[model samples]
Target: MKEIYLIRICGKCKKTNILINEEVEDTIKKGYYISCSHCGSKRIFKENETSDLRKCMDNNVYKRVKGKIRQVHSI
Candidate 1:
């Protein structure tokens, strides 16, 4: 399986901000803050504020599993 990453979308620039799982955890424990790299907007260091990279990429209409490719549709 491919490694998944955490991401936060910038509200102002609509840019994706990637985050390390370990770093996020540590930051939450220490009450540190995070910001958007593109627009310099402050971000909350909460799990609910971020999303999994896989979930973000689910908008793709196609997917590949093993050696085969298939179509995907969103409701």
Candidate 2:
């Protein structure tokens, strides 16, 4: 099976991270990512025994779509 991932979305500007993290359901729902991609809100994502490395979209684009895939990373 393909690896699933989770993401964080900004509440203010609706900015989201381009880099998807291999996170769990609760973790993503609780809100991940250390900060916002656009407005740069200081979000404190609790840490565990996971790596802290991530990649982000430079233009801060919002990927809009409406579809369903067989493998999905719930958030």
Clashing pairs in 2: none
The digit string of per-residue lDDT tens for model 2 on 34-54 reads 566556886524222223322
**Consecutive 10-residue window with the lowest summed lDDT within model 1:** 44-53
- RMSD vs true structure, all candidates: 8.1, 12.2
The parts of candidate 2 lying over 4 Å away from their true place are 1-4, 22-33, 43-75
What is the lDDT for 22 in model 1? Answer: 69
Question: Cα deviation in Å at residue 41, candidate 2?
Answer: 0.7
lDDT agreement with native, every candidate: 0.59, 0.43
